[model samples]
Target chain A: EDQVTQSPEALRLQEGESSSLNCSYTVSGLRGLFWYRQDPGKGPEFLFTLYSAGEEKEKERLKATLTKKESFLHITAPKPEDSATYLCAVQAVSRGYNKLIFGAGTRLAVHP
Target chain B: GAGVSQSPSNKVTEKGKDVELRCDPISGHTALYWYRQSLGQGLEFLIYFQGNSAPDKSGLPSDRFSAERTGGSVSTLTIQRTQQEDSAVYLCASSFGMQETQYFGPGTRLLVL
Candidate 1:
């Protein structure tokens, strides 16, 4: 079975603190890995998509890197505004359509 | 351009009552998806529609859940005989293609009492 697991269920960091969230996945064939940020009572906002191992992408203060069995979301100098639940999902090549298997997510809090 | 949109930001209902949620995909998006998110949980895939193909409903939790995409633009999710466990945020997403990045709507919060 394909599964995704995110580590560190919750984290608290002071403003400007840098950290990384981990997502490990098991799939028949890796197709893509996605990162999303979700605010309270809001849907997830797309962050980045990594297709192959060793691939990385960035936006603003966030960077995402993918490997054979895991992916990491790096937050640099995070601000309170960046506090949100980070979600990681994986798309398997064996799936007929674009179905994504998602992890439980990691809740992050940045304090000033 | 406007992103995906869902109707009725919040809904309160009694158990056994039926509820319907709506979603409008992006202007030219050919793929639309529906998911359920519980408090402190990740997204649970519910259904998906791509162009004129048959919707993928494998993720629906029960037979009472059904969805339809009309004209490949707007989609509706209907839950029959809602249960307290059915309460959650229903999210809608749309993309240019099946493999493309999906943009999500604000989501509809459902509470069954």
Candidate 2:
């Protein structure tokens, strides 16, 4: 079975603190690794998609990196508004179609 | 809709009642998905639909939960004999296809009291 696990279930960071959230996976074939940010009542908003190992992408304060077995979402000098549950999902394209298997997610709270 | 839209932003129902949640996908999207998010479980995949083809219901929790998509657009997820365990925010998302980026809606919060 394909699985995704995110670490540090919850994270607390003071303003300007930098940290990284990990998402380890065991997938047959990786088509893409997706990152999303979700608020309390809203659905997840797309963050970044990494298609291969050693690939990195960034937007604002969030940067996503992928390895063969895992992915990391690095936050650079985060602010309170960056607080939310960050989700990690992987698409097992080897199985055909883009069926994404998602992890429970990492809740981040950045306090000022 | 400019984005995926879910109906009844908030719903409170007594246990044993049946409820229907609606999802209207973005225009021209061929793939749609439903997921549940709870305080403890986070987000879980429920079901997925692609075009007018048969849906992939593999992720549905039980027979008590069923969903149907009509005309390859709007979808309705029906829960029978809802239990307190069913309380969660049900989210809907859509993409151009299975491989495209998915855009999500403001979820429908269902509280089974």
Candidate 3:
């Protein structure tokens, strides 16, 4: 069974549209949850790291919130440059500290 | 400061041929990781190295895949008897000692024929 799952395999949004991406995870001894943005033919760029329920962090127009069962990446007034795949991952004590189990990702396309 | 870097941005090899992928992590980072992303799939954990401690090899898919970090810096992932199923984008990441945040490299796209 996959430990991490992401929804809306593909999402198309108009410029200035605000939305959220969901990431549900099932893991024992959750260490942390991570959000990343990946562009074509490139590695993932770090976005946010949420460590516990009710934890939230924001950068620019992006914000991440975490709870016991899931995490969300909310984008505000997104620009075309924000179009990319958003990935969510988790680390578990069982999997050790160095490995990250990633979700299939949500492909987000923002257009003007 | 530079982030993680990988060599041979792309590689094409024949089945049964051996190939080596290299990763040069951030200068002072003590933890390095290797992952593979197949077409339309998520990143798969492969192996890990932390300082001088023995690596965590549990994520390696098969014995044919092995990696070694020399002098706590550069790492090389060697795939022996590469198979078509091995084709993927190999990515490397690194973080500070025992830290949870890992920054990734651009990745090396490997294609097996």
Candidate 4:
């Protein structure tokens, strides 16, 4: 069975604080790992796609790193605007079609 | 220039009634997907349509849930004999190809009374 688990279900950080969220998964064959940010009442917005271990991607104050069994989303000097639910998902190579298995997500609050 | 779009930002219906939600993918995107999100829950895959190929409905929770894509551009999700537990946000997304990055719409908030 393919499953994704995100730790630290909720996090409260002050502005300018740095933190990291974790996403662990068990899949038959790793194809792609995705990160998304979803605000209230809106669909998730794409953030990054990590395809292999040791790969990393960054955007402004956000950086995502991948490993064989997990991924990490590191936030640097996060702003209040960065507060949202961060979702992690995985696509398995064995699935053939583009089906994504998603984690429960981590809610982040960056207060000023 | 436009992204994926879904109709009826919010819908309220009584239990046992049926409802249809619509989605319009990007101009040339060939892969369209439907998902359900309950309060504080992650996105649950419902169905996927790619070009002229058959849709994959394996993720659909029940037989009462059905979807269709016409002309490979627009899609609709219909829920029959709705129940209160069916209330959730129905989200639509599209990608250029099977493994490409997906773009999502604002989503339709369905409320069953």
> lDDT score, residue B60, model 1?
94
lDDT for residue B113 in candidate 2, whole number 0-100? 96
Distance from true position, residue B5, model 2, in Å?
0.8
Report how far residue B23 has shifted in candidate 1, in Å.
Answer: 0.2
Which pairs, if any, clash in model 1?
none
Computed on alpha carbons, the lDDT of every model, listed in order, comes to 0.92, 0.91, 0.93, 0.93
Model 2: CAPRI class = medium
Q: How accurate is candidate 2 locally (lDDT)?
A: 0.91
Model 1 docking grade: medium
The ten-residue window of minimal lDDT in model 2 chain A covers A93-102
lDDT of 1 by residue, A2-47 (tens): 8999988999999999999999999989888999999988888999
Per-model TM-score versus the true fold: 0.97, 0.95, 0.97, 0.98
How far out, in Å, is residue A30 in model 2?
A: 1.1
Candidate with best DockQ: 3
How close to the true structure is residue B14 of candidate 2, measured as C-alpha lDDT?
100
Candidate 4 — which residues are off by over 4 angstroms?
A: none
Ranking by lDDT: 4, 3, 1, 2
Query: What's candidate 4's i-RMS value?
Result: 1.0
Candidate 4, number of clashes: 0
Candidate that would win on TM-score = 4
| Root-mean-square deviation per candidate | 1.0, 1.4, 1.1, 0.9
Per-model clash counts, in order, read: 0, 0, 0, 0
TM-score of chain A as modeled in candidate 4? 0.98
* Per-residue lDDT of candidate 3, residues B6-112 (tens digit): 99899999999999999999999999999999999999998889985546888789999999999999999999999999999999999996556999999999999
Per-residue lDDT, model 1, residue A8, is 88
Predicted structure 3, TM vs. truth: 0.97
